[model samples]
Target: MPWYAPRHLEEALALLAERPGLIPIAGGTDVMVDGNAGAAGREYLSLAGVANLRGVSETPLGLAIGALTTMTEIGRHPLVCRHLPALAASARVTGAVAIQNRATLGGNIMNASPAADNPPVLLAYGASVVLMSAMGSRHVPYAQFHSGYKETIRRPTEILGEVIVPFPPDHAHHYFRKVGTRRAQAISKVGLAAVLAGRPGSWECVRFGLASVAATPILACALAAAITGSDHSVPRDEELAEALGRDIAARDDIRSTADYRRRVAINLVREALAPWRSQGGFDASH
Candidate 1:
């Protein structure tokens, strides 16, 4: 595919609308792989010169992270680290350092990979994507953005603008763990993001989202809701694992068996909530 760098998003959007075979390329980390394999005779809109689609800031709603914000920046941002620690942790482990330097949060989300680390974290944080077109702009929750494996609801003419994540409550804690073939530079076999709040005797919020264990990354809403109001602190790991095994719709893939992913998802849930067993509340440091 031939490449053209658009100076502005409007130009890119216009090109996308006019050119039936145009592909948008930001980091090109994921796109190029397909393009290199003879998915050609098309044009690519490079967003490197689009200045507006970059940066991270605190917004009235929460944090507004620009579509082009790199994983490296996301991992190191003090604001991100302090508030959305799971996201920060996810970004840090998202690839090797070099890929992190080039990978954008928007690209990561737009890729819509089942194993993509950002989605689990962002979904757990209740994040939304700001999508803009020549017509107008709209916000879509991360959970709803992905419709299927490697597929998103984004139209070709619409550009992903930014990500909005509401700040979790001060009492909230987060955990992100990925099971892969290697420690780094390997795709996730099973990834989990868990967030919890409140003290031992009372439970306020309990959310768990897992990647590479379903058709699309999922927030175990039904199960989370089931345990949200309970006073029980030491999680019933076995029962929870059984529930996960029964509830999660997983399939055997090259990474692992569906049964294995199901097992890991349950264990991740248990481990993430294990901190509550101690004297204080959950801890993110672990």
Candidate 2:
């Protein structure tokens, strides 16, 4: 019922340390939705005024995307677009323009929704999260951040400080697709985000991340191995299907059926890999 608005990051961290149950609100996009539904009864710690947590910066490791950076900023920022185009694409497709203006990278991850658009992209790019507390900060690999559905490794005492996206190889292939009821503002029925290095065959590195098909946005390690090990040839559909079976854990949900999601996920992978199968290699011009 009470609201705590802090103008500084240190002040916010102190408040969180003193009141472990304080719910942090940045964009308030999700929190307001919960409040409107009579579900958000707890006091809110507003981080809107914490200006330090709201921009993008370069770091020795890669790009340091401040936690409070709005989806719209991410989508339009030249740095993000050049280095992590899939992330930029995911941000552009997250919600309508208004929602994108308010929704933030930190809030999205902290919400820990299995169908969230950005997590799969983060996973695919081998990103890391910087979680800060009054004590200090720690980095958690994005792939290991989500432990289960609607849950994350972020501690109650810690605030997500920033997301660190490592630079991919210059010739890397990036792909992202989200299937939902409609294009913008709809929750994803299934989504895939991937970063591939080297050619289709003789692949040097591969990371495929899928959403709405597992307890968490998952790295399809088994599927990646199957494709990467295919001896410079296109993998058969059966092989792809079997690897997908080992990777995803889709189930019947209101938006789609387990069978439908499975089939669609495989098809999406095939479509993304079509460049590999036909072009001899990724064509950057397209």
Candidate 3:
């Protein structure tokens, strides 16, 4: 296999334009696994030496995470843990330390796996993807980035440069949960994330997302509306859970049956939203 390591982002973009079949390799964890299994074809564009594409920084608006930033870095970053703990929590469960050290956020999203831990949390945070191409650059909302299973909106000439996440307001509470076959080193059977904004009692804004239950991570807009507009100060637990269960469109798979995943997804939503109900609403500290 041929590997081209560009020193600059522009050079990388140009290379991608010329060689559309060249897979971009960052930490190489996912690509290496596929290569070892004879699933990846020869030739790749290695982004490791691209000096501009690394690290996490706080921008005026929110946070800018380099596509090359490893899961290990994100999971332990003080700023990320403090501001977006749900994302940090998702990063912590991506894989063991070794895999985490070698897995990049860009690779995770570009891989487009329904079970990728970060997507649900990113969706809940209203994140965006910074895509670069020889033609130019553009930002795509995370929700619109994924087109289908293992597919994304990124053009062949474009490379995912960074992920931008806006800081949540003070009165926002976030939660994430994943159901897998076992407690450790397991891919998710079902994953869920929720963000509630405004006072707990008021709940002016509610966002819910789920993974491993559809073609891609899903935003449960109807469910969020139901919880946010309910006349009851606290959501009706049974009713909300039932609504969540019925909202999912999962198909039977090797890891779990469709019915089982639907049940787990609903239960996870209830679990994630419980804190908001208990606190009498969203807390600023969240």
For model 1, how does the per-residue alpha-carbon lDDT over 1-286 read when each residue is reduced to its tens digit? 4877888888877777787466777887888677353364767778868978998899999999999999999999999999999999999998899899999998998888888998898888888999987778999988799898888999888889999999887768788999899998889989999888776566656778889988888877866755653455554676576556654788898888988887777778867877766644653433
lDDT of 3 by residue, 187-274 (tens): 9999998877875346655888788988888777768767766765756877676667655679898899998987888778778777
Task: Flag regions of model 2 displaced more than 4 Å.
Answer: 35-41, 200-202, 282-286
Cα RMSD to the true fold for all candidates? 2.5, 2.0, 2.2
Considering lDDT, where higher is better, how would the candidates rank from best to worst? 2, 3, 1
lDDT of each: 0.82, 0.90, 0.84
Candidate 2: C-alpha RMSD to true structure equals: 2.0
Candidate with top TM-score is 2
State model 1's lDDT.
0.82
Lowest lDDT 10-residue stretch of candidate 3 = 34-43
Residue-by-residue lDDT tens digits, candidate 2, 29-48: 89888744334567778999
RMSD of 3: 2.2
